[model samples]
Target: MLVSNVYRPMVFGCRADEPLVEVARWMVDNEVGALAVIDGELVTGIITERDLVGALATSDDPASQQAAAYASTQIRTAELEEDAREVARRMLDAGIRHLPVQDRGRVVGMVSMRDLLALETWTA
Candidate 1:
C-alpha cells in the first residue's frame, strides 16, 4: 500500500508566528497530536504534542512563545507515493510517531504510526 492510501488527507496546521498557547488550544480543539508550521507557502517545521509538552516544561511563559520556537525544523517526511512499509520503517528508525506527507514540495497530508499499525492489522 502507498502512504496516500492510509494518510489523513486533511492536514491541520498553524502559522509559525502564531502564539504557542493558541496553537495548543487548536490542537486540543481539533483533537490532533501535531500541526504543520507553515511560513508563507512553505512548510518550515512541525509542532507535535511532545514539543508542546517540552515547551510547557522549559518555558517560563509558553503563551508568549511562537509556534516556530517549539516546532521541530529538521522534520522527517514521507512522500505520498512512498510505500507504506518503507514509511513505517523510516518512522521507526527515526523514533517519530507522525510524518508529514508531501507531494511535489507541498504538504498534502499526515500519517501517524497508529494509522500504519491499524492498516497492517486490517490487511492482515
Candidate 2:
C-alpha cells in the first residue's frame, strides 16, 4: 500500500512561534497526537504529544515556550507515493511516531505509527 492511501489527508499545523499551550489546545481540539510546525509555508518541525508532555513536566511556564522549542526540527518525511512499509521502516529507524507526507516538496498529509498498524491489521 502507498502512504497516500493510508495517511490522513488533514494536516493539522501551527506556526513555529505559537505558544505551546495554544498548540496543545489545537491538538486536543482536533484530537490529533502530532502537529506540523510551520515557518511560513515551509514545514520546519513536528511536535508530538510526547514532546508536549515533556515540556509540561520540565518547564515551569510551559505556556511561555513556543512550539518550535519542543518540536523536532530534524523532520523525517514520507513521500506520498512511498510504500507504507518503507514509511514504517523510516519511522522506526528515526524513533518517531508521526511523519509528514509530502508530494513534490509540499506537505499533503500525515502518517502515524497507529495508521500503519491499522493497515497491517486490515491487510491481515
Candidate 3:
C-alpha cells in the first residue's frame, strides 16, 4: 500500500522554540508521539517522545528547555506518494520511528513505525 493509504493528513506541529513541557503536553493531549517543528512553511525538525525523555533526563529544569533543543534536526522524510514499506525501511535504516510526510516540499502529515506496523498487520 501507499503511504497515502496509511498516513493521516493531520499534521500537528509547533514552533521551534516552543517549550518542552508544552510540547509533551500537546502530545499527551493529542495522543501522538511526535510534533513537527514548523517555522513558517518549513519543517525544521521533529521532536518525539524519546526526545522528551532525553531532554528531561539531562536537564536540570525540563520546563525551561525548548523542543528545538532536543528535536532530531537531521530529518528523514517520506513522500506522500511513497510506498508504505519503502518508508518503513527508510525509517528502520535511520533508526527513527517518526518521519514527516511531505508533498511538493510542504509537510502534509506524519508517518510512524506504529502506523506502518498496523498497516502491515491489517494487510497480513
Instruction: Using TM-score, give the best candidate's number.
Output: 3
Q: Write the per-residue lDDT of candidate 1 for residues 1-124, one digit (tens) a residue.
A: 9998999987799999999989999999998899999999888899999999999999999889999999999988899899999999989999898999989877889999999999899999
For model 3 the TM-score comes to 0.96
Deviation from native of the Cα of residue 13 in model 2, angstroms: 0.3
What are the lDDT figures for the candidates, one per model? 0.92, 0.93, 0.91
Query: What TM-score does each of the candidates earn?
Result: 0.95, 0.95, 0.96
Residue-level lDDT for 119 in candidate 2: 95
Question: What does candidate 3's lDDT look like per residue over 1-124, in tens digits?
Answer: 9998888798999899899999999999999999999888778889999999999899999999988899988988889889999999988988999888888887788889999999999999
Candidate 2 global lDDT: 0.93
RMSD (Å) of each candidate, 1 decimal: 1.0, 0.9, 0.9
Residue 30 Cα positional deviation in candidate 2, in Å, after optimal superposition: 0.9
User: Could you arrange the candidates by lDDT from highest to lowest?
Assistant: 2, 1, 3
Q: Which ten residues in a row have the lowest lDDT in candidate 2?
A: 86-95
Worst 10 residues of 1 by lDDT: 99-108
Kindly report which residue stretches of model 3 are placed more than 4 angstroms away from their true locations once superposed. Answer: none
**Full ranking by TM-score:** 3, 2, 1
Tens-place lDDT digits, model 2, residues 1-124: 9998899997789999999999999999988999999998888999999999999999999989999999999988889899999889988987899999989988889999999999999998
